[model samples]
Target chain A: MTVQARSLVQITAPRQTGPTLLDRMRRSSLLMAILAPLAILIVWECLTRVGLLDQRFFPAPSSIIVSLFALVESGRVFIDAAWTIGRMLVGFVFGAVPGIVFGIMLGLSPTVRAFLQPVIAALYPVPKIALFPLIMMIFGIGEASKWAIVAIAVFFQVFYSTLAGVVNIDRIYLDVASNFKATRWQLCRTIAIPGALPFIFTGCQLGIGMALVIVVIAENFGTQVGLGYLIWQSWQVFEVRDMFVYLLMVSLLGYGSQMAILRLQRAVIPWKKDDAG
Target chain B: MSSDPSTTLDRTGLSPPAFPKIRVRGLGKRFQVGKAWVEAIKAIDLDVQAGEFICIVGPSGCGKTTLLRILADLEAPTEGEVTIEQSDPSNPLSSMIFQESSILPWMSIRRNVAYGLELRGVPAAEIDKSVDRFLALTGLDRFADAYPHQLSGGMKQRASVARAFANNPEILLMDEPFAALDEQNKALLQEELLRIWSETRKTVIFITHSIDEALVLGDRVIVMSRRPGRLKTEFKIDFPRPRRVYDLKANPEFGRIGREIWTLLREEVVGP
Candidate 1:
């Protein structure tokens, strides 16, 4: 049979109506976000005041916010955050660029992959922090050492994800490419890079997460200008409130950076199924 | 329209061609499942003239796909020789419209349609012209800027068809491109495909399990046996040109041919 003629669009736009409760909440997502954290902080502050929690270890949230503001006013938070973020970005750029480059190379060529896979496999399992002392021996305890540790830590995550992404691209797509008689260079440019991009972003996200962990630990050793330095410094001086403030800043950085990456992923790969706006 | 199979040769050129457009002799594929060699297809011989629409129909897992792949140069046949006579050096040898999810999801409809041409490094102006024409022809012009994820399954396959046509390859190889669609979509696409194909009679090798689809689309419907497939029967469909699928099936001869194919295939499908 044949001659079936009609529209292809299965999904029609829903009828618009007055804003429901769910719609209202979705519209005020930013407001909702602020309210939940603020309410939690207020409850914690009240609990501290009532002596329900130990004031020594668990300072009032209000006092911590005050210290946070004071730290901001003194520009200490900015300096520390700037240092930490700067190192993370530098390390991320160096590590991620090479990781993706090598990922594409190894994914495409089995000869090189077979030769180097064992080396990569053996090296990836070792804790990155354990390599820091070895890194310090080479770069010394300074910005170079911090940068090296962060970059090295991030490289593994990005490389693994990029490799997996490229290798696991649907066979049909590659078959399509091959039918068109694409050159190896054309294959990489047209298919491998774009196809592996979603996975590369996944790697970058994990890389950034690890970057934060490594940066804080590396700062604990050599630098006095980062959030990690402030954290360790606060512990030594017993400035519990300052410790809470800096620790809060660390968490904010982690959350903020992850959100920034998600935003970047949305911008870069707007065609991702669930991620499409 | 010449219904004669002999007249199908050399439609592109004024003079008759010295050779067939495609030559496949004793083609066989063996897949290794663990340590054992699994015979996917065995000792297949086929010849397709230029500008001919040939459809191969068989039961599922009959290795028709593997045969199509070998012709497309995506897979190598272990036993025999396969050659595509490329008349023009500039045009690609073959372009395949896959069963599903063949079009790149990351690209917009326009870009996906233009992908093959872009890979071949054709001039941008020519690429744009062909792409625009095929997009509109496929009813995807309105959604030229839309990505594959935004389109329906049928629409995505339409884009894949558009891509193959836009590339203007010498031979078109399709592996059950409509197998994933619903009946309505399948009919619609079938009509559209026949219309497009009539306009440009590129040598086409279509593989499908649907006997009706084969009869409706092809000048010759080839039937193959089960796994480790070998060609069993060949029927020349002498339906006159511009035959619509809806009207053609109503003919008593159409039922006769379909039943003949079903009978030939039943033994292979039912075992012994």
Candidate 2:
């Protein structure tokens, strides 16, 4: 009976209601997002071909793509992308997981929050990039220093946001859960985590982006064989198209990870999407 | 519809009279707002027998909810003791339905109903049976997989009531569970509530601002004064079961009881 009713609804309903005018406009905007970058690349290529723009300074998209293809064929692009992504993941895990755990502990307990939040707030604004030189001085120009810099850069952002999320959860939900005889651990797992998930994810998203930016910059201080190293090496050699290729690689990598995180969020926390819709 | 109405009254008069399943003594509450301490409840006492349907009605800010919270152990009273004769404190003997849904938005309807059982370490098989039973009782089985956001206000309250009853609580404390619903839904839910209450026989302590609701649901309606809230008077209702909430208003007996309670309440509600 239930199956019959469900099928009836599905059969009667329009396949889509068709995309509204607003949806068409949004699709156009997405097209524009793609077109904007293409237009910039085409203009650069045209200027360079016409000798109005110097290929020596600004690289054309086609040239950059050729350089990118060469790097891919040599497996340099794939290896470098893998290495950078690995560093980012490890750094994010080290920084974000512990930061959130401690942040929530501090937020839930005033004494802990009072002791830690001040230290965090004070150190938060200081440019973590400044510590890159110090990290390299100690850890040397190995993977250790790169990973350390990325971890440190991501930590404070995720930590503070987690603290805010825990502190801001509606107290009434706590009261209701408490009255239901929910043990402390159950309350934290079922109520606290889900309640603060969106905020924590927000922090994670920002931290991941910031970590990439900081790690690449830190890598530039002294590095070999990553996207940042490739960019720096190409620029030093005045290989403009190669530098542009590495830069484009970094942007694509970051965009890919962001989409991955968003998809993960939707799967792990379907309720978040329901609340929004 | 028994030939002898009093025979079906279901009363067993015994020596101790089952110790009034729930007893409240010298209940009071105070909240500190910045520099000033505001008293929410003055000393008050009440007793609820097993299977008794009681409604506490008062104006807004009259501490009716605070009183319910005190009974539910959600709020510690400034000065009071609430004793439930046969219930365990470790596992809640009473479950409260708040003014809003409060069914934990993150949980599906089935999980929400099963929450108390889950807390008590009930096996998955048992939780499924109990949740299914209560969901059917409240006519919410159709929405077993739905989230609170997917439900209308009335449906949410039905889920809340089902969740509250899934544990077979000794008492149910409802704080205006239907005040937010439209009149039609409100009446329907009220009738549904009575049917569930009649079958389950759990003692109920409901707090509401609606006099009509009190007249319809309460076996005993306690009128409370405003501000430093106190019990002004009590009315014993002899209305029969399966009472439709709207039909009671047209019955002359309901008007007399309404006026009796209103007489005690009008001064507190209207000032002076």
At residue B198, give the lDDT of candidate 1: 86
**Over 4 Å off in model 1, which ranges?**
A1-36, B1-18
**lDDT for every model?**
0.89, 0.82
lDDT of 1 by residue, B1-272 (tens): 12343321222333256678887778888999999999999988888888999999999999999998877777766777766777886787788999977989888999999998998788999999999999988999999999898999999999999999989988999999999999999989998998899888899999999999999999999999999899988999999978788888898999999999999888889976
Best by DockQ: 1
The superposed Cα distance between candidate 2 and the true structure at residue B11, in angstroms, equals 26
TM-score of each: 0.90, 0.89
**Per-residue lDDT of candidate 1, residues A178-223 (tens digit):** 8887889999988999999999999998999999999998888977
In terms of lDDT, the best-performing candidate is 1
Can you write out model 2's per-residue Cα lDDT over B1-272, one digit (the tens) per residue? Answer: 11334221112223275578777778888999999999998978898887899999998999999888877767777786666755544445778999976877778889888988898888899889989988998889999998787888899899989888887776899999999999999998899899888888889999998888998999999989998999989999888877987778899999988887788788998987
Q: DockQ for the candidate 2 complex?
A: 0.43
Worst 10 residues of 2 chain A by lDDT: A1-10
The list of candidate 2 runs beyond 4 A from truth reads A1-30, A137-140, A221-223, A273-277, B1-18, B87-91
The positional error of residue B262 in candidate 1, measured at the CA in angstroms, is 1.4
Error of 2 at B57 (Å): 0.4
